[model samples]
Target: MTQIIRTSADLRDRVAAWKRSGILVGVVPTMGALHDGHMSLVREARKQSDRVIVTIFVNPMQFNNASDLDKYPRDEAHDLAMLEAEGVDVLFAPGVNEVYPDGFATKVSVSGISEPLEGAFRPGHFDGVATVVSKLFGMTQAGRAFFGEKDWQQLQVVRRLVEDLNIPIRIIGCPTIREPDGLAMSSRNVRLSEAERAQAPALHRIMTAAAEQIRAGAPIETALEQAKAEILAAGFHDIEYLEVRSVEGLRPMETFSEPGRMLVAAYLGDVRLIDNIAV
Candidate 1:
């Protein structure tokens, strides 16, 4: 059974005991909607550390749109069951108040890497991510952290955050898990309507093909334009962005580079889906 921790003090005490015993703790931070993608991170954590902690906090600060925040899928009972089954040592599902007390006034913001793509579309988002992630690191005091590569830009931002701040925790990025149909698994997928869900896998298919084209010597802009057109015709409401960027600095790349990642963000009905792959 996974111990559910809801307060900072209690989590600190528990981590202290583990540290005293020379146990290396690992943490998987999440937003309370556990899918196979999240489970993959937990499994990696279990394999890499003596103990594992999975945090489920639907951070209010990260959502630029209020409705999106309210609509974010959250089922603590189900999430806890999944963690317990994975042998997670703790679930730090803190309430908003617990994470951001009334007097809270600090924010962690990473510049440059965070100013494009998702950041450009969703304003002030990474500030919230950085702040909460830093808080989780301080609260859990884990030796390592796990994140999915599906949010490629996010992984980069968190990496930059850890390095810039000199945070002690090591950030481990796992591969993006996909469904049988090739659509990347995300907590927000539950909100996709039947028809929309049926058409959603095109995002991955189209991006994969485009990445291959770039690798095969096709022009980057030409491939992106074709992909955007295909995505729109595939029943997506809108294509916010579809481009290749440097894997490390996340700089927009017009020509194929040695290490690049192709990322996309499209809307299906009211749900916004993001996916990425190596180019």
Candidate 2:
């Protein structure tokens, strides 16, 4: 059976002990809603490390709206059972009080790149993400960390964080897991109603259409404008952003380039969904 650890101090001591023995540690950070998407990360970690430590904490700092934070899913018993089945080695689950003992007065912030796209929509989301991820890397002392490309911007921010701070951890990005209809799997996906769920695939369709346009030598602006129009016409309430960025720099593109990313976010009712594709 995998060890279930619920306190920070115990996780610290156990990881520290593993470090002295020179064992490879892998960390997978997540909130406590275990899905197949999350299991992909856990399995990847288990394959690569001598021990895998998965941290399940719903981070309050990441949510700008109180309702969104309050409504975020929680199924601790199910989450633990899923992790144990995936051959997870250790689970580092800490309470909000345990994670932010000082009440989150300190935070991590990345400049420039974060202000565009999703960051523009949710003010301090990345700051919360960066802070919590930094703490996870420290607590686990992981040699490698796993993330999904579904949150491509987040993966980029974390990659930059590790590089800039000289944190000795390798980031392994797994491919985005998707529903059969192509909607990327997310904890937030549960919020969609049957009708809303039917419309959810529009986000993925938009990006796939953009990729085809880019492949056909269309201009970047033309592709984005067409995709935005299609999404709005399909009845999505608000289009937050549709950006084609250099995969390396995450900057707005003047022209479409192969091996780039097309990122889109839209609101259906009040639930926001993001999807991206490589072109």
For each candidate, what is the lDDT? 0.93, 0.89
Query: Per-candidate TM vs. native?
Result: 0.99, 0.96
Model 2 lDDT-worst window of ten: 251-260
- The C-alpha RMSD in Å for every predicted model, in order, reads 0.7, 1.3
Q: What tens digits encode model 2's per-residue C-alpha lDDT throughout 99-208?
A: 99874587788877777888999999999999999999988889999999989999999999899899999999999999999999999989988889998888788779
Best by lDDT: 1
Clashing residue pairs in candidate 2 (N, C-alpha, C atoms within 3 angstroms): none
lDDT of 1: 0.93
Candidate 2: stretches off by over 4 Å? none
Q: Could you tell me how far off, in angstroms, the CA of residue 204 lies in candidate 2 after the best superposition?
A: 0.8
lDDT of 2 at 157: 91
Give the C-alpha miss distance for residue 216 in model 1, angstroms.
Answer: 1.1
